[model samples]
Target chain A: MIQLLRTLGHLTVDGVWQVGFATRFLFAMLRHSGPSFARFSLTIRELYFSGVLSLVIIVVSGAFVGMVLGLQGYDTLQRFGSESALGSIVALSLLRELGPVVAALLFASRAGSAVTAEIGLMKATEQLTAMDMMAVNPIARVVAPRFWGGVLSMPLLAAIFSTVGVIGGWFIGVVVIGVDNGTFWSQMANSVDFREDVVNGVVKSFVFGWAVSLIAVFQGYDCTPTAEGVSRAITKTVVYSSLMVLALDFILTSFMYIGK
Target chain B: MNRAILDLWVGAFVALGFAALMFLAMQVANVSEEGTRGETITLRARFEDIGGLKVKAPVKSAGVVVGRVAAIRFDPQTYQAEVEMKVSAAYPFPKDTIASILTSGLLGEQYVGLAAGADSEMLKDGDRIEMTQSALVLEKLIGQFLFNKAAEGGSK
Candidate 1:
């Protein structure tokens, strides 16, 4: 019984210590971010790896998700004889919820895990240590660029996902199901407010980007310097960022949509 | 990848992202269309019960939208619901135009409908549409029907 209590206390203390460490690491990354902006090409190179490379998965998945929404929405809306509303239903759902949330989840697994693994491997191989010995700031040169790359990539990726998804929905809802084309487009335009739905969705993605990037870089930087530790850190990056994205999504949605 | 190739790919990616945003704003949300709807003048109407008439609900004339509901207020003294509509300047109605609450379908959204009057004077901004009709309540209609049936049966 005492062993169990000791284990629980140890875990509680470890978790709190890690949280404090992460907060400090975040400030360090911010302080060292000047190189990322001043030497913009370095950030762009990282963007190519994280952003451009992730495009195929984001677009293909977005299309499939949208098509599924269209099929299901049509089946249900037809019962109420309100099939004309399918456009708004699909667009609103994609923009308001699925676009930012699902895209961020995918990003957590795809780029977030990769960022962790890359940084963790560099540490394990003593590359970061060598940079410090050579009087080079590894945090500025290595970590900051990758972090900004992710932050810049997330919103653009989310936008592309939603746009592709809307087209996929259109294909299923309009072309295959025989809903009136004009009605579908007009209904979508009439119902979706640019400021209310679209702008809020962009904001949600931006916040998610900031969170997922920070968590990814922090995990990589704080991991134990060993092979096994690097693998575990990569896993933690995916898991923790996914959870953070979902929790933040709930808070943002409540603030944006509830009450009015 | 080579630096030039990387730059090109990033440029293309950024361009595509912006294009997607443009599609959302123009094609899906109709931002430009709303901007081009022309200047509008406000008109007021009062009803006993507005039903589900929401702000931004379309105000139609001859089955075509000419305006949108701008505000809805309640009067304490007369116990009436006051609605303010912003109608486009292009479409002008006479002073005696009737504004009535209407529903599109049985269970669909409610809107405001205007029936023009053959009067010489045109309605202007901040003018009140005096001839106003309240929304039709389904419960009230059913109750009246039942009452009428009971009255006939008692007479018989």
Candidate 2:
């Protein structure tokens, strides 16, 4: 029992150390990212890999989610004889909740995992060490662009998610279900507050981007220089990021909405 | 060749994203009040209690939004809440239009509903709406219900 307790204590210390290391790494990446974003080629390449590639999945999923919201919202609102509220229902749900949350989850799982895996591969192949030998900082060259690319990508991805989702919802709710398009659009405009719903959602995605990117790059940078280790790091990136996105969403929602 | 193509697509993607965000801000958010149904004139009304009434709450007349609540202030002298509204000039009301805080559903968003009254004169900028109603405080109703229950228990 004492041995078990000692092991648990050691794990706790290691966990705290890892968190501190990641925080420092994130700051270093941020510092490196400054002015270095002028090296547009590297950042743009990372952006294309992370952001542009993530677009198809984000848009497709966004449309599907919006369609589901429309169908569900219409069914629920119909009972109240207030089917006119279908637009507001779908719009608010996507803008306030699902758009940021789901897009971030997808971004983390898709691009974030890719980042970790790529970095892990580089580490395993000793390419990072080779760069280090040549008077090159691996973090500046490697980590910063990926980090900045992610931070920039998240809010835009979320916006696309919301816009596509809203349009998709409109397609189903109006075109398919025969709900009035004017009522759909106008009610959405009327009820969905700009600051409360839209701005906060964008803010949420921006923060999520910071978190997921930090996790992805850190995991990659610190992964054991082995094939199995790289695979495990990818898994960790997905699991921890998804958990953090959800947990952070709760905290942010409380601060933004409920505290007011 | 690939780099140029990638840059173009990236540029297009970013623009698409910004456009979507702008749409959300403009259409869904009500962020830019400029050109929001034409010019607006500021007006004020005094209420006993504001409840959950917030700034930017729609001011509707006959179920059509004519303005938004711009600001709220507490008049310590009268212990009343002063609500300032920015009514669209296109939807100006008569001088005697009654502004009441009406809630949607059982307990939902509160908006200022203006009922047109019999008056030849039209309300102008900086006009103080004379007839005003305060928002019903839901907490008070719940407190009253609990208080009655406690009173009945005491009597029993």
On DockQ, the candidate that comes out on top is 1
lDDT for each candidate structure: 0.92, 0.90
Clashing pairs in 2: A194-B29
- Model 1 off-target regions past 4 Å? A1-6, B35-46, B66-98, B114-131
- Pairs that collide, model 1: none
List each candidate's DockQ score.
0.76, 0.55
- The local lDDT score (0 to 100) that residue A131 gets in candidate 1 is 97
Give the alpha carbon lDDT tens digit for every residue of A1-260 in model 1: 99999999999999999999988888998999999999999999988878998899999999999999999999999998999999999999999999999999998899999999999999989999999999989999999999999999999999999999999999999899989999999999988878888999999999999999999988998889999999999999998999999999999999998845
Q: Which candidate is the best by TM-score?
A: 1
Model 1 clashes, total count? 0
Q: Model 2 chain A: which ten-residue window has the lowest total lDDT?
A: A29-38
> CA lDDT of B13 in candidate 1?
86
Q: Cα miss at B154, model 2 (Å)? A: 30
- TM-score, each model? 0.88, 0.85
lDDT of 2 by residue, B3-114 (tens): 9988987888789889999988887665655334668899899999888889878888887777888899999999999999998888768899898998977856899999
